[model samples]
Target: MDFSIISENLHYYFDGLLITVQLTGISLLLGLIFAIPLAVLRTSRNFILTMPIRFFVYVFRGTPLIVQMFIIYYGLGQFDFVKFGFGVFQEGFNPDNIGNQTFLWKYFFSEAYFCALFAFTLNTCAYTIEIIRGAIESTPFGEVEAAKSVGMSRTMMLRRIILPSSLRRAFPAYGNEVIFMLHGSALASVITLMDITGAAGIINARYYAPYEAYITAGVFYLCITFTIVWLFKKIEKRIYAHLAPYVDKTQKTAAVN
Candidate 1:
């Protein structure tokens, strides 16, 4: 257990930590943004509006995150259209011809970082949609009835009441989702993205100190987990403060006496 190797290469781990946080943070933010509208649509009775979203959610949620990342990173490159560009499919099929590659393929899909980001966004978005949809669906009937009684339009009611309440209710669950995404970001290392786990792997490879390398990575993850837990607890307390039971000071004093 030569832990000295970890101290020597601490900078690598810090760099990896930045990548992990950036990857996870961006993915979660984008996922939440996309999920908001999709979740509302999911709660709708309209099949046309809901089916496509349902299928998308099903496909992403049903599959493994690592498999999704691999398909995005490696599978897309296998296609000639992506490799050689649209010309291969459009003009003529020539095995030797390296056609003009697309800007999208060259700029985004061809890169490991973009591929991982794409996968992470889609994966997190799918889960977030379901999390919010469930929260929206679980909204109390009385509230809906009260809103309807007041002649509140569907849009107005959702904006003013349903959404606010549902979001508050979903806060804790969403916090958990954020943490899951953080842990899942480790998969980015598999695609050679140089995340925290990737840094540890490199250290282990060079020094042959598996315990030291991996344990240092584990400690970093644990610290992150604790910080997340603390932040969520604080936010939950603030958001749910109104729901906390109020006790009269006089009553407490009387009880004490």
Candidate 2:
């Protein structure tokens, strides 16, 4: 209702929205970079190769993203390995008058933004690998055999057929993951990342109007969500257009008209 408050704080919202978008984008990029290879290895029968991926996926998926962020940003700070990881740099950065915290401790744990990004990447990758793996496994044996009959090598089949088709099938689920990561970026506020939720918090504190502050933030999130859905729908129509054979064109036309 208090639109003026939002107008006054527009700059804060803009900065926070940018931070949220950046965090989600970076996390998805990192997750995608690792998840593909990890998914392939995860499908392998070799326990040695697969076990590590499995364990990583399990741990990340099993735990809360917030907990992971805390462990990296705070919990690991309690350990000597993390503390002494870069001793030389640690000593160089330390100065007197800073209470109880050392240079290394402050350097690693003090960066909540980095910690949140790292945690989001790890968590999203865990879920994404599974999404991709399921898609890959769902690829028909007949199609693979058809590729083989056409003289495609295993590597060629994967690169040209399986990977591409699997990704297409995985897109809908992957899009949901992207949106989830966007919303999850709000948790960054807990650690002072100044994301959308953080901006909303600041607004509430400044104006003493939680309704106005949070409703505006909610509108921003809703707009982002709608945009993502529209994009995904466009992608889905493009990728799945090959289903024309199973669908009756006349009925489709009639339904559309």
- Which regions of candidate 1 are displaced past 4 Å? 92-99, 247-257
Which candidate has the top score in lDDT? 1
As a TM-score, model 1 comes out at 0.93
Report the lDDT tens digits of candidate 1 across residue range 1-257. 77878999999999999999999999999999999999999999999999999999999999999999999999998888777666676655674744466778878998898899999999999999999999999999999999999999999999998999999999989999999999999999999989899999999999988899999999999888899899999999899999888867768777677
Worst 10 residues of 2 by lDDT: 88-97
Cα RMSD for predicted model 1:
2.2
TM-score of each: 0.93, 0.86
Off by over 4 Å in 2: 86-109, 244-257
Look at candidate 2 and give me any clashing residue pairs.
none
